[model samples]
Target: MEINRKIRSKKLSTRVDLTAMVSVSFLLIIFFMLVGELSKPKIMDLTLPNSCDISCGPIGCFKANRFYTILLDDNNKIITYFGLLELPIQSPKELQYGKNGIRKELFYINKKVREYSASIGKPNNGVIVIIKPSKKSNYANLVDILDEMKIANIDSYSIVDYYTPEETKLLAMK
Candidate 1:
């Protein structure tokens, strides 16, 4: 009496098809991947180089015999160039100094550069422009200023630390 001879398939075994589930999971992964890529914020990275180990002191105060120096200060200001304060800086949109007053600021500054070139019996065309961006200054502004400087025929350039104590003493004179 123990064994029921044949249990006529009395139970319905349910099996779930995982194909659709797998497809849905893949789609979700793709969506998140693309969204994460597109939603990323655009950021500007500025890496201040460690290559500028050379000390700029009173020696840098005077333009090198073959080098033209343009100083970039903390305020994104192009201060003191070729032994003069406020070396000509033209504005971005103006053709003449004091005209539209935008482009000429840099043009005027470059004019001073040319004058310095002539005074020193140099070509002034491929001069070296020194960048002294303050630790607190805006990097974008520095880049903009450098772009303008390049437009002004100053092709070669450098970045140096400003105000080495003795250098400050010299700058204080004017």
Candidate 2:
């Protein structure tokens, strides 16, 4: 009589349970979506001037003495002048970018304009700045100038693309 032995095989399952993983992924996506929705984009508000008759002739809408023009050129060069280039109250001067540069000039001019307006009994009227960006200028230059305007607390300013004949001559000199 010989002893007999029996062998048994263990069974294995091939299916996987992905319920927890799927739930975690969905939660992460939802969290990111909610975070994105909660954050708002920063933007600047631009106010445009109303329509005026062509007869106003460039600086006609505003008094010439209170008008301040800033010309943005390539390489961050800024040429500024008070009143018309033809008859500038404060002849065209090349200024650099930043606090000691354009910002300083702006503060000085703003104060003077305010005093002049007050002397003339037009206390409400303030300095009007005209920003003329040349074709050679970049978008960053425009934005920087706009920031300067805001920093200087300027209430009235406009971005003009066209360059006058005198302005073209002035830029050519640079």
Best of the candidates, TM-score: 2
Tens digits of lDDT, candidate 2, 127-169: 7888999999999999999999889888788899999998999
> How does model 2 score by TM-score?
0.74
Clashing pairs in 2: none
Off by over 4 Å in 2: 1-39, 48-62
Question: For every model shown, what is its TM-score relative to the native structure?
Answer: 0.39, 0.74
Across 17-112, the per-residue lDDT of candidate 1 in tens digits comes to 999999999999999999999999976443332233233586453343323344443444444444323232321121212223313454555566
lDDT of 2 at 27: 100
- Which residue window of length 10 is worst by lDDT in model 1? 90-99
